[model samples]
Target: MDLSDLKRLGHRSGTGGWGLGGLHETGLEEVRPVGVGGPWAASGTRASDAGEPGNSTAIAALIRDALSADQVVVREVSALTGGAIHAHHAIDLRAEGGTVPGDSAWVIRFPADPSFRIGHPPDVEAAVMRRAARVGVPVPEVLKTGQARAPGSVAMDRPYLIMRRVVGRAVASELVGLGTADGVRVGRRAGEVLGRLHGIAPDAGVVDGLIPPPEDPAGARLANLSRALDATGAVEPGLEWVLAWLTRNRPAPVPPRLVHGDFRSGNLMIDGGSGKARLVAVLDWEFARWSDPHEDLGWLSAPCWRYGRRDRPVGGFADWASFEAGYRAAGGVAIEPARLRFWQVLALLNWAIIALGQAGRFRRDRPETLDLGLTGWRLPELLFEMLRATAPEARAEGADAPPPASDAVVLPAPVPGVEDLLHAVRRALSNGLPAGPEEMGLLINAIGIAERATAAGGMARAGADWGDRARSIRRDGIPAGRSAAHHGRLLAETRARLTLANPRYLIALGLD
Candidate 1:
């Protein structure tokens, strides 16, 4: 879609669209608003300073201290888009003296909020990147890293990692829009990169400080999901059923390998400058860990990561055959279909929990963030997929079919209706208001939720006590020959949620 269309409908687009690829990246911030000026646009604002939190002066000083340089001149520091938990700034600097590189472009990364840190610290990430680079993986080189400390202790106030910036587009929409030829080529390269990454032996020093793979991967993951669900304190019968199904169908254990926990389209930096899209660097190693290699494969192929291109299973670019070929050509082990499917289901479950956690984080720590609040609303979508994937009927008859269409609910329009009120506010905001893309997205989503909830008559449709049913299923087992009824119940319950969370999603999937 064009920029104007994105601005009007808040649809998914390359630069600023509110749909799938736009707001879905794990921790990436929303794109800058359309028509907004770049960092250098405003008068009196020096190129060397973008008014971002990490100012050039402090960064230059930090570089000077780290390199023991006599002088360091920071030419510019501009905020890069797409980092939710961490803030990323591109730094251009020239240094003179002690082991200094003459001139360079680098990226400085640190937690947006120090208290909301996830995964390993900066030092460990630096070490992991170094190790990955040593093993032939395309990754940025870490120049310096700082540990989190009390205020006023250092020039860089937060724990941070500085690395040489690699030139490439990491946006998912842009990558997926590259068409079939480039998709296959990029997908193959990604597979090759991942193959090499997973080739890192379990005994390697890189495994230090990283969470090791569990003895029983499926069981451990199921238990973790159960605990996370409990923590959310939200009743999720569908998830419970999926949990029980997973418990029964645990895959046989395999040897552990280095897994890029969040390996997917958005996290991959692709360079198309040479005419063909190629994987230049694998980004976002914060979630890297020791686990079943299939975990990485499944995550790469997960439907959610496809950016709406479900046909191309491997990151919305290439088929499994091509990706598998690349992996094997790079000396990776052969993949088993059953194991891959198992991990794919687990991946969805893991993502659902993550969505809950992000929503919780928004409520508890960052109430002002509309993005996190929206993430919580995504659980229904995630859980719907989980139910479809793990339902007993799906196991018998294939699970690849699209969800069947259901009748759309019609609602009465009352005086001063909530949906109408939200639509009016949205129009006012979209017309001439000084709202940013983030604010616009929030308003659009709020309107969508209001409209859907209004149509559905409420947030949910009253029916069976799903929580009790879930408990029984988890305790006993899925009833034999009742797969049809089970599937129907799942569809009904999930559709109710989707109505409130995203009616467009239901329509797009042919469920409405």
Candidate 2:
């Protein structure tokens, strides 16, 4: 298998700077050893300077002062990967006279960049998590939340949240690799947790400050994506078709409930022991809001979250049947097939939109992160994933013949074979080059992009073909012959490009 194939089994890329080779390591805000927590100490800064370890020392001191401790010692400060949108670190704290009473591991989360803060502010997020935890959702205990710079904390310039760090890994690759039975166990547990989360009453005040639960949840979501797409100024006909399809097949309104907007594999934490795996925590509540419960269900079951274990719909680890059983057992309302499909489609589109934003961050913001650029390279595959999900029904409705297998198209070539150069660099990074997981993920991702570029000529041709067919349908009428033809061609092109982009996905879906 090539690098792309290997990457399919890897964790989602981290938002960190990248390089082909040479030394690259994710800097900690402080180099506090795991077991030691003491007074403030400075450390090196990263390129962004936003996640400097020195700031971690300040945070440790801040926590110390907040807790009314004589002195706060940061035992360990380690940057935690996987929060692509936020910069975070796990700080093992030792407080002398803090209100909390003793030393413990805490997580401090701040924006990846100073200019952009996600959903709610730190205080708001802490409040939401506290409410969710009270309602029986497995979440970390929020210790403190504020924007005020604590005494002795000098590097902090924005709001931050300090929460008890829960154990277990959030890495998808590890969770997906759990033994089948163990994986299913984890999935069922996650389903139960989500069901309980949805069971929280709307009057619980969790949605305060966020937009009120929209009367038309699906429409509201689609409109949000439409706005995001508009902002991107990048045209995607497949995405446009998805928008139209969503409008045409809108599901009946369901009462809005608490939805974990980004509920999926990577966001969940799993504990494994004695040959079994269990859901430890349901995290990343930045996107949590009042929405249809099925929205959470669909997002959890989306193909993208499954990694390569596509057979297990609930996650990459358990089937929908098991997941649904757990959900029902936990008092979650029955999931409607149509509504589930609707949200699942929306989940794909929403993820694609987020990926676009990631790419845009790299292109527009010029962050030192290379993962953003690699994320941009995934647009075609992401759109095609949406098409694959939406096009099959139209095929049954009498669309035209499937387009021919993607044919080779010649394109400009770089001096050294691009794929080879990428592979070599990736090898260097993988083989003893000092780089953190985040940087390595980016390098691996770059290699995948380079490999996929080999098929760019074919993918571009297929996209143009589909775009023409799509425009023809748009110009004609809604239910005209051209619509079916367009759908069929769209499916064919999506499958062809998807085959090149991620054949593992097709095989996982039994399409291979």
**Clash totals for all candidate models:** 5, 8
What clash pairs does model 1 have?
Answer: 27-84, 28-82, 28-83, 29-82, 29-83
* lDDT per residue (tens digit) for residues 375-444 in model 2: 4444545666677667645467325746644565211111122343364455555567636675565555
lDDT of 1 at 278: 87
- What are the root-mean-square deviations of the candidates from the true structure over C-alphas? 8.0, 8.2
Scored by Cα lDDT, where does model 1 land?
0.62
In terms of lDDT, the best-performing candidate is: 1
Cα error of candidate 1 at position 317, Å: 2.7
Q: What is the TM-score of each candidate against the true structure?
A: 0.80, 0.77
For model 2, name the residue pairs that clash.
29-52, 29-53, 30-53, 36-75, 37-73, 37-75, 38-73, 38-74
Which residues of candidate 1, in runs, are more than 4 Å off? 1-54, 148-157, 204-206, 360-369, 393-438, 461-464
Best by TM-score: 1
Provide the lDDT at 222 for model 1.
Answer: 70
- How many clashes does the backbone of model 1 have? 5
**Predicted candidate 1 versus true structure: per-residue lDDT over 41-103, tens digit per residue:** 122222323443446556666666777878888887776655445556677888888676598
RMSD in Å for model 1: 8.0
